[model samples]
Target: MSDQSALQAVIFDWAGTILDHGSRAPMGAFVKAFAAFGVNISIADARGPMGMAKRDHIRMVGQAPAVAASWEQKYGRPFGEADIDALFAAFEPLNVASVRDHADFIPGALETIAQLKARGLRIGATTGYTRPIMEELMPLAAARGYTPEITVCAGDLAAGRPSPLMMWHAMAQMGIWPAHTVVKVDDTLPGIGEGVAAGTWTVGVTLSGNMVGLSAEELAALPEAERSRLRAPAEAAMYAAGADIVIDSVADLPGAIERISASLKAGKRPGYR
Candidate 1:
């Protein structure tokens, strides 16, 4: 059998894989929101909740339960609910702005999708953003000539990544019934877990995007061993969470698929290792 028969669809994560540095945009929004509240948080701190629901992630970043106390300790003054609301309101604009303003197609992303489509495979997207946010992004993305055959917005459903609902829904809508016929690509642990839980083949993309914010210069500066150092954590996370294959990036997807096809042919499930 041809390798294509092993995969009927390719599911992708929107922010980081299809667009450039997905998490970085959200991180900037988080930093901006915290700065507005007089609670300074670094981008590094904001990235910790990358794949979570936006509001939930923001709440964690904002230290919601003890917002006043946390702000008092961190900023030398207590912040009121109004202050928190104002900060979150400012951050809210970023949810749509990130995709509309800076959602450039990742290098090789379109070409890869085109190649897969040529092979008769459907393409899909999953994101933590709400449906309205996705509506806002679709036009902007289309304006720039990027599109996915199917798109799953986290808030559109009851649950997000790490939950199989979004993936299952996307597959159903795309007419791909067999979970193993679809391959999910993502840079986050929850996303990988969602794919695995949905029983779809999973490929973890690790290079130059949301999973890591390595600049081209930074990536080039690292030796192969050091590069693996940067990627190992994400790989381990995805593997433990249920990824079938861990790839370096969307650029490495074709090769990764080849490897997955080989393993599947050999009758080895991806996470068995």
Candidate 2:
């Protein structure tokens, strides 16, 4: 690797990228929270803004034309901050409880992280989860042998993913500067966008993320052709959203890092294309 191109750190997203295979927990919490207000949404809608801060995600969902119409019809007014607050109130405890159940590390995630750490790469993390949720999750993830050196959560900053503030925080805390010296790995488009905005090499994880939303068991059970069909849209979405690379899961992350390192050696920074 070119000396200047050597990676100093790798920042990962929490839920779908690390702990929760298929990113199942948050969607359920979002659905339940909305239903509590008598507005129903499909799983796809809930997943649409999956990488945003929980409250922002709820706000985005509520602002959807169809959801907004329903809210107006039901409550005689468009959804607003109050609605988002109420939904988030319902969402937090449910999400906190559900997180433990979904905390199983994605297959090979721990091993992949271990390998990266062994190479002297500082592992930092950025998450849409708030600190309290992360407090619950960190210990669970640690038990599984996968904990980043630094973790920047949603509310820790004034803005979250797609804004780059959280990623910046991670880099600052880890003492990794010059965004090109890092890689941001995540499973959602907004997360990828955050990496792009931060000027870090961005890798999008498919199969085990919001894009495909399949548990390890569920993905393994699919025939090769069907699995490809399911993953195509999500892969394309990530690429379209500016992911420099897309891998099947955290398992494929090492290879991506190798390739990104090569590109860096060739003097290609993120967004170079």
Per-candidate TM-score against the hidden true structure? 0.84, 0.97
Across 1-273, the per-residue lDDT of candidate 1 in tens digits comes to 334337678889877777755446677777777777567776666776676667666656666445446687876755555555677678777766765655677777777777777777778888876676778778777787668877888677887877899999888897776676678888777778788889888887777566677655567778999887878887777777777778777877888777776776777664666
Give the range of the ten consecutive residues with the poorest summed lDDT in model 1: 59-68
Alpha-carbon local distance difference test for all models: 0.73, 0.89
Give lDDT tens digits, candidate 2, residues 1-273. 324678889999988998688899898888998898899998988999999988899999999999999999999998999888888889999899999889998888889988998988889999998888888889988886777888988899999878999998888777778889999999999899999999899999989998888888999999999988987988898899999998989999999999988899898888776
Candidate 2: worst-modelled 10 consecutive residues by lDDT: 1-10
Root-mean-square deviation per candidate: 3.7, 1.6
In model 2, what are the clashing residue pairs, if there are any?
none
Number of colliding residue pairs in each model: 1, 0
